[model samples]
Target: MRKGLPILLALMMASTAVGARAESIGHADLARLNETVGAIGRRLADTDARKSDASALLTGRLAGIGAKGQWQVPTFDTLAGKPTLHTIPVDFMLAQLRLQTGGKFAPNAHKAIANGAAPALFIRGGVMSLDELAKLAATQHPGAIEQRGQSFIAHWPIVIWSDAGLVLSAGQQLELSTGEGAFVLNSGLFTIDRASLSSTPEKNAILPEFRPFLATAMTGAVQAREARFSNLGYGETGVTSGLSIVGAALYPAKMRSSFSDSSFVGLNAVSLENARDIAIVGNRFQKMVGPAIAMSGVTNSQILGNVMMGTRMAQAIDVQNRTSDIEITGNVVLNNRGSGIFIANDARDVTIEANLLSGNGRGGVSVVRSACIDISDNVIVSNAQVGIKIRASDALSLSGNDLIANAGAGISVLDQQKGALISVADNAFSANKSGLYGGAASEVALNANDFAGQSPILLDGEFAAYVPELLRMSSSPEGAPQAFTIHPNAKSTTGQTSRPDCKTGS
Candidate 1:
């Protein structure tokens, strides 16, 4: 029995030592240990197990490292051109992985062969199992899945360059202005600049295929593709991202706080040049200094559900120069220094609806030299100027809108410099200085508009009231209603119909 016990104890000690050896400590301090080791001997010792294992590990892990020369290891210090996995034939490595995973390791070959060389790959890089590559491309990346008690990492095949990138919670965003193609974010976050966010990306040199990934929640989960944006003219360090607003409210409530003493921070935020598709919503902006949202030369973007506080500027929401197909809806522009919503020259096909504008500086909504606008269901009230002001553009329509209590007119049209045509219908105007104000009467056509103000009338530049019969000249009423300045009698129906007169051809 004593002999058996001694043998059993010896066996246990052997098992512990074997386990510790299997766990294999490679030098607690690799730098110090390598420095202490001096240099490798001149001649190759065929029987040296330690040298072979170190070489094998380094060679095995070399390709797995990213393209950007990482970790500056002494193994990479070239005294001799020892075996590097990077220099080895890719076919050999692929052959080994093929044997390891029974050919299921062919990440690209399977997709490429099936699609006949169609590039379904979002990014191109290092050899990894099919599963590993797919997981790397996910928004969550390395954290997307866990299996077999190991965290799998993949290597990038190509390198790209970018500056001033933003690493949001969901994905990494970069601005590669110089168009260098060696940038990568295999893990973690980075800041990229704006140049790469614009035309350079579209130049087709290297097209980035963003995969569809789960977006951060505004409400119920949505599958939104991870996008690479450019020219994101940002002055702030980090903007909040990851919340997907797919036909959902950017804000918690349907509306934002009113403009008072200016507590909002987004107003001070600056623009990014060549920027595109920036989601600026769900923020509070009241009593702001600049335009609540000002965009120039931006495209395919959305600015929804934000409040533009009163400002000294000419507009709360101003879009300028070649900006197209922008959607401005469900916002509140109150007491702004200028017009509530202003679309300027070269801005086209914008949709402004379901917004609330009160006490604006100029008009409620002003559009200049733009076309194909749809202005509907907006509540404009107490603006110092007109409720809805449109000038110098064509094919514009103001329908199903409510304009009330403007200091001047409810809706005003002037100086159609572009020979643009406008149609105003089914709108309600109440308690404005004048319900509808116009310059060239014949240029515009107003129909089915309900006006319920005391002096509901269109006027000339001189405030000479409108007479439908004398469409060209400004005129006042005659006799009971008055003249030069026509005052419609509150009692009489004809008085209500009568307007200022116009001299014949003069």
Candidate 2:
């Protein structure tokens, strides 16, 4: 039933790399490796009475018909030169893993017995992720280590670890809350447009340790919009916490991933780290425990036009680490249990504009250890704490904004690090407990700020609110009130938040 006389008797190396596209077989050892594995599948099928002969088809041919009448084939388009990588069909890989345990393995494994070789294969399945695979492998069969960087000598020595390219088109439904949760890691080119991927609540009790999640690795690319991800995640840490793009930093500039016009409910967070060229826009995040969106070490991204509410105990937007070149624009952040926006840990070169920040538990905008941040044209109203809390930051501009009805001061410049310059003007301050609460160490210049009840009251200095000369706008640094040089490297972002619908949070 097979072709050619290419007899493959020798075992493959413990780790073998597969090319992305099928080319001519170059090395004799590779040809032998393929043919030998093919022969091993046939031999296992002949003796393994528990499995039907049709299940033994190991090639990437017609797998059994799916519940939806679609065929399930191997989805392997992986990187080059990865250790323990294989290009065989997924079923073929599963078959080969069954041969590693020699007929004594867990119930999850596909059983087989080698006539001359003693079927001893243990390829792990039904686990949530690769990290969980490492922990749960020994539970299936002892002394069976399939972790990366470990050496295991099976009858067929090559390891079978591959990445997946998952696509859920429109009008499709993917169930994640099955008995064996469907956790897809090492993701590649994932696209789910107008589709739904969710977990059912009733199935949560059967399995306790693992929850379903789909995350990307180094081979990352995503095009998800108008999609829904709900009730999927485990804890508040790791990429498995929710729908995440973890460590997929190799995305090209042009093929940026975006998750927009979507809905996420009852998840921990849309967590991302060490990735680039991403856009999270026009989405709704509700009932999230942590920040609705958490980004760290990301670059060249945008978070725009989203509505984030009902977060339990975290900010709606949290940008941390060495992230840069981001725009937080046209979003509605309301009633979060924490601060509305939090930018810290040297997150620089960001623009926060045209957003509604109200009804949050903490300050509207919080900045610490960040530079070159611009906050303008935002309605900071009715928050439980101060409108804006800045500490140890430089080159921040607050212009053409409204701060009203906040429980604390309108703006609190807590710690004024040296060389930090804040330019405040053309903003309305009304119904706050105080306006412009800063110490003598705060290097700020205020002009034309329409204060209603309270005005610029320096804690350590005298009140200069009604002084017309001090409030006069001055172009020269020496003539300006609280004269100091604005950071020359930082661009001036004054009066730039005049988009016609900025107030609409569109």
**Which one is best on lDDT?**
2
Location of the lowest summed lDDT over 10 successive residues in candidate 1? 71-80
lDDT of 2 by residue, 309-392 (tens): 768978888899987888887666667899999999988878887666777899899988887888877767668998988888
The most accurate candidate by TM-score is 2
What's the lDDT of the predicted structure labeled candidate 1? 0.40
Q: Stretches of candidate 1 above 4 Å error?
A: 1-273, 312-314, 440-442, 454-506
- TM-score per model over all chains: 0.43, 0.61
* Local error of candidate 1 at residue 128 (angstroms): 21
Residue-wise C-alpha lDDT for candidate 1, range 448-492, written one tens digit per residue: 444322232434342243334322111222222121212222322
> What is each predicted model's overall lDDT from 0 to 1?
0.40, 0.54
